[model samples]
Target chain A: MAGDGRDERAWVRGAQAGSASDLEALFRAHWARAYRAAYLVVHDAAGAEDVAQEAFLAAVRALDRFDGRRPFGPWLHRIVVNRAIDWARARALRREVLAEAAVSAVPAPDDPPDAAAPSAGILEALASLSPEHRAVIVLRYFLEHTPGEIARMLELPRGTVNSRLRRGLDALADVVEQDGEG
Target chain B: MTDLRTELEFAPLPGEIEAQQRAWRVVEAAYREREQLPRRRRSLRPVLAFAVAAAVAAAALSPPGRSVGGWIQDRVAGEPDAEPALVRLPAPGMLLVAAERGPWIIRSDGSKRYLGDYEDASFSPQGRFVVGTAGRRVTALEPDGDPRWSLARPGPVADARWAPSPGFRVAYREGDTLRVVAGDGTGDHLLARGVAPVAPAWLPREGRTVLAYARADGTVVAVDVDSGARLLRTPRARRVREVFWTHEGLVAVRTQRELRLHDRRGRLLRAPAAAVRRELVAAVPLPGAWIMYAEYDRRTNETQLVREACFGRGPCIAIGPSRFFRGAGRLRDLTLSPDRRWVVAGWPDADQLLFLRLPSVGKVVATEDVRREFDPGGSGGGAFPRLAGWCCARASG
Candidate 1:
């Protein structure tokens, strides 16, 4: 999201005038966070690409209706993070159904966060929490949005945002203190 | 030690550049296509524009944990507005949904009433009565969720079903033994032993006392319950899961990986070939010469609904399986409507009950918030409800 705001505004104006270069620049500017934010939320490489692509497509369709005066980062990210959450929730439910059919056990909530425990424990630990918790953590730390900004972006209460952040950090506490090599 | 932010930024995101290139191509293509379209007149007031912007933002940013209907408003992308709740079914009929707590009767008008805390239930022939099983008790209940009669077996009873037309007998399984009782809940007697745990299928013919069930040894058998006559017995099928009987006298036996159609006399007719990693989860033979089945891919986690047209009652012509309606996760319990034009499948992965329009996708109407709608005051986080059966085939109720 860090870029020249004046240039971003000009790029939006040019893209609306059918300038492919401006559209490409605008895309490159937002694609990283959109893709990374989606990856952190959904935790699938192919799915992250899909979420990013769909969000970009949606942004293109809404390009004409978009007001150039407004920032594009939040608009594009709104699509990416939301679709990622939907994808994750659906996967969780399907896993629960599989567990039920095979073992007849109630689904343990990820409310507090895979057997695929990777050597890279941060993403794995992030995956341990529920999708809602993951979304807030990604928005706060990965995307660097303020608590109030995250609350508004996710349509959640500020208290709810803080609580989710607390729980999410608690889940990641072990890996947090360790160096990135862990 | 670095904090979580640095670790995340440094995380090795595989195929980042390749993904960006692929995604950019798609984005640029969409951008170009939209650029070529004719512009629409935008004469809206500022207030209307802001409202539109808010709706778009709400739709795009809304968390699925809050509202799945909005999350998947048009999941497969056809409808403009998907109902957040089951306001009404697309067609006129009753639906039976078996949640973890109990079974419920959703009427044609979208009004629902809980039947009871029974584990299993199905409507009687005409949808006037329901038979439900819980623990060792099988109770017959009126349409209003009131129990009319119950018969307790010595062990756990399951898969209880009523006889066709006039409803003279009710057949159920107690442990591994198949048992039958009169329609009035009297004259309980053992029908067979060593029965498979699969639910028995009753002959759809009016006043017919013939029933087909799988034995524990994996053979499908049809018997005349009245005279105790063994009508037909097929060679042992491998991992037979279900047996379905059509009104036209054709018996379809479904196994873990294949769907085999057999003649009324238990002769092997035909079957769809099994594909690797693609397991046939559920299949049902619809009257008027059509068989619909749901298949799941173990590798991809995609559930596909395929329809095959039959040349006759016994064996189907190899017109090939027409694959239609593929979605994420497992789409279980394919229940056909009275007209056979609609197939309802429970998509628990998304908390969605999709009514797959028949003959392939003319339209797919979905009802969301099913967990909350069916679970009443529960946290909406319990086991996703199962579609027990579609009742009142003709909506006489």
Candidate 2:
């Protein structure tokens, strides 16, 4: 679903001009990764779909106001990741009200099997991190956003983003090593 | 340790393609349906001319216009008390209220948390959780507004009700199909196809999974979900609004025109003939075979709250004269307190909530400016909030 710079820019221009085909092209190019990033943060298929759907809807609402010269991917990704974080935070508050001690384990991914797939152990370890920590790791590694950009997107201090990335990576490493030992 | 970035870059997400297709369809539909905002026109000379002429005419008619407007205001505005900010509730339990922004959970001390963008919501049996629905998804949320589990259906979901404990079943309507899911969000299966849009009512008994729902064919049917057997099937009403399981082993079916009670075997148990003509708004089962209901009169533009005793063997007897809560408009969404001592109604026309203490002098406590209280930071002019439920006491912190 990745779109190259020229194609992405052209689609954004056409979409802003009210061309449905170009809008669809932009959606198709960004849908999968957007949905995946949201899924990783919220860890629920339905919630991820909702978060991504809301992000695209927000984009459409703001299309006329958007600057066509700017790149579209980071803008869309920002909305997706931020909404996913909000969804996860709301779920955490609900769990506190219910007095549940532990968040539910992440469900098995729906992706078809591939040799290059990350191990289930790593995915499980990723789920064990708080949603805030998971969001930092996802932005840094999956979305390829820099720490400063993530801090801006999430409204967090740059130092806080670095600390979360460090702690999240260390936790994932510990889980993977234990899985290897067992 | 391996580079964390390498592992994350290759992480797989389940149902990625299907999710994308589903979401894109919705997004594309929304985009196609969006109406363009109207742009401002550039000229104002003709508008200024018309406004000046109208202002001259208005001055000539000012005396008569003022009199007519004042008369209309007197007719529409009820006796309004000084509205204070919602600082605390008059009772002890939490209140689930639905405003235009979303559903909100208001604590006993009048603190509130907006439970994200849900359309309809209901409290779990013990007040431990809230189940909310939006679009095609039904989510089980913690009281503070976190999601526990969510199930997405093929159609939009509505009217979700969690069964009483051992709280195993949740029944909801998804585009005319009644679906039941296990309380923990597993074992979701179709209970009835082509059912009514009304929310299913579970029998309020311990360890029982019997549910009553309206069918598209107009009949109100009760079934035992565990045994897959129909417990009772009653004759159809004109337009069934809701159905409830009464404490006296009868099912109360409310249509727009009348309230009818049926026995466990589905025999029609009639109410007093005098109570038939008025439009039944809402009803709740009271202690000791009594039913409290609100009835509206369109001609007089008045609403009355009445209590009647129905023993299931004979016609319902009027317990006393109906009490009128004087208001400029209708009072709706009658919800009884957990202790069954207070009944709350939302008066949208007056922008207040009327609390009626039952079985006594019928003392009324009216809280004003309810719309602003529930919808903080909102326009204060949207639709009034509907009282979803008055839950039991919160667990001790």
Best by lDDT: 1
lDDT score for residue B380 of model 2: 47
Steric clash count of candidate 2: 7
- Top model number, DockQ: 1
TM-score of chain A of each: 0.83, 0.87
Compute the interface RMSD for each candidate structure. 10.1, 12.8
lDDT of 1 by residue, B1-397 (tens): 1567976777778667777887776667656655554533221101111011212223233222233334334333211223344645666678888887678776654545566568999889888889999989999998656689998778999999899888999999999999999988999999999999999989888899999999999899999999999999988898888888754577889898888877867887776577879888877776566788888898977777777765444446535437667766677888887666777888766567877666654567766555755643223567788777786666832
TM-score of chain B of 2: 0.78
Residue ranges of candidate 2 with Cα displaced over 4 Å: A1-182, B1-79, B271-277, B393-397
User: For candidate 2, lDDT tens digit of each residue in B11-77?
Assistant: 6766677767766665665455433333222211010110111211221222212222222222233
